[model samples]
Target: MKKLAVVNGKIIDVEKGSILQKNLFIEDGKIVEVSEKEPDNSWEILDASDCYVAPGIFDMHVHLRDPGYEYKEDINTGLRAAVEGGVTRVAAMPNTNPVNDNISVTEYMIEKAEALFLAELYPIAAITMGQKGETLTEMGLLAEAGAVGFSDDGLPVENAEVMRRALEYASLFDKPIIAHEEDKNLSGDGVINEGRISTLMGLPGIPSTAEEAMIARDVLLAGYTGGKLHICHVSTKGSVEIIRWAKKRGIPVTAEAAIHHLTLTEEDLYKAGYNTNFKMNPPLRTEEDIDALYKGLADGTIDAIVTDHAPHSKSDKEVEFDKAPFGIIGLQTLLPLSLRLWKENILTLPELFKKLAYNPARILNIPGGSIKVGEPAYITVFNMEKYTFTEGMILSKSKNSPFIGWKLEGKKKFIIVKDKVL
Candidate 1:
């Protein structure tokens, strides 16, 4: 690949723990140098004067329903959505029509993703066979097949012994056990969060203890088994507090607050008579919980932010809000919502990049979260002043994003892959 220079932008090296206003030189799909003095014209220049050029964004949790559910999303369109969302890399959840439970299935996903455009997709294989939670899948083989991590995702390993074993085994490969964290009996047939909203709406409610109980148990399991545990799509204030307490006590635990949980409250569920878009597992909580989610983000209690990027068809979410599938698409809205946090001064821009890029990359052990020399040329350029978000412009296959038609500041202008920028 020929050398190329991206000039006149604020370069934020999230992993390097610094930012610089300079020109970046890329060669062979990796950063070769970063210098303040724009040198002689020996390379192609990508104009970035009005943009913030940082390491490509990373989403540690996204459901790119592929293989069995191509009608919803495939590797092709899912990746396009990822890049359009400024995500250069995503660790996809294991829940699918036929779960990615073995080495062969995991390998097929890796092979197909390589033949596509947009951000890189790293498959997270299922932790159990069929996600039944009875027997553990072949961890070593799956990891060798290029599995980024392991999770049951939609289904938590309800068996404490099974959960404990999954964590212990995954530790051997240095991969984290991503727990969905809901006790089966507690969340069974539960709809919205167990609170006033559930009572007011006449919907079944899942107790916050449903999530917190599992989290508390998992922290104990991690402490006992000596394994790394990561909590995904944490929604409850109780879940947040447990993760904070566990982390403070030095348990190997990290948690992420979902975008919707951060920005929206139970009030959105009541809007339009309990909108289905507001329906999600660990369902939307009260204003106090939303405040706690923000507090978690600001105080560094929640280690990262995740999209949970679940997509359902129009028919899927068109059902009654009570019966609709859980989750809303957000890979496209993560950055802008994060910008809201930044604008409120709850999180600095560098801190925003750390949650969106750096910390998640560290947790996943991926390498695209920095602008340091010799790192892969995964980068994103965004306009700081252009505050516009239009509907149907997102590149994802399913347009079920809750951020639809909601205006947001900050926009990604272009991205750099290996030899190309768009």
Candidate 2:
């Protein structure tokens, strides 16, 4: 690999929550120097003028529907989407065809990602066998096979006993049980948030209690069992309060808020006139919920921001709103959408990258969340610029995002993943 230099950029120092004007030099896939001096003629140059150079983004919660659901998204296209979105490390949910419940499936995902050499993929194995919520899977064996964590993401673990066991078992391997918190009984056939909109539309509504109740239960379980608990896609004001309370008590809990939940509201969904692309599990809530989520991120109650990145084929999302699958492709829009936080002053640039990169790395115990000498050169260079997001710009096989054709800020100029630049 040729030595490369990134020059004339403002480097975000996430560790210190500051930015510095500096240049970086890389060789043999690792950062060889961080200094003010420019590299000589022998080095290849990447001009980063008028851009922010930050650690590579790590999206901890994403659904890469490989294995049996390649029609929706495969590893190849999924990772491609990831890199384009400036994400260099991704932790994929274990909701594939076979559910990623065993060693073979776990090994296959890891091997496939290694071969692709795009954004580093970390497989999160399922907490229960086939996600049935009855029996636990082989967490020990799966961890040995390179599974970073365990989750039954698309399906919530309804049984408290089962959930408690999963938390405890995952703790033994020093891994987190990433929970999809929802009380199915409360959520019951609901297509959107429970409020005026649901009543006016004459559709069943999913009350905030459905999510808050489960988060409450799981956090207490984590406290009792001394296990690591990570709540996924927290969507309610009540849920944020619960996570904040849990963190105050130091109950071994962490949580993430999805980009859509943080930015969009049920009002947007209603205005979209039943567009299935706006549909997602734990559905979009109100502006009140969005405000609470922003506070959660600002105060460290929410540790990371994720896309969920659930991709379904065009045919899969063309059905009636309630009948269609819940999810929208988000990989290609993660960075630009997330920059809204920084632009709005909810978080500074360094603080934003901490959630986007540093915190996720710490949660999953993975690498590539920081830039420093002697570390692998995983970096992203981007600028805040307005651009219209078009369907044609989507690199993922799926085209289900609601943000297409929307004017958005933040564009990734390029990403350096080890020795290769994309």
Count clashing residue pairs in model 2: 0
Instruction: Estimate, for each residue in 1-422, the C-alpha lDDT of model 1 and write its tens digit.
Output: 58889999999866565667899999988898999867577788888998899777888898989888887788888888877877788889888768999888888888888877667888999999999999989989998898878899989998899999999999999898998988979888888887788888898888889999999999999988989999988887888898889888888988888888888888777774767877888788888888888888878888888899888788888887767989888888887888888899888777888888778878877676778887888788888654556666867777677677787888888888766675
Worst 10 residues of 2 by lDDT: 365-374
In candidate 2, how many Å is residue 399 off? 0.6
| Candidate 2 lDDT, 220-311, residue by residue in tens | 99999999999999999999999999999989999999999988999998889889998999899998999999999999999999999999
> 51, model 1: CA deviation in Å?
0.7
Q: How well does each candidate superpose onto the true structure, as a TM-score? A: 0.96, 0.98
Model 1 / residue 223 / CA error / Å: 0.9
258 Cα displacement, candidate 2 (Å): 0.4
Off by over 4 Å in 2: none
Per-candidate clashes, comma-separated: 0, 0
Against the true structure, whose lDDT is highest? Answer: 2
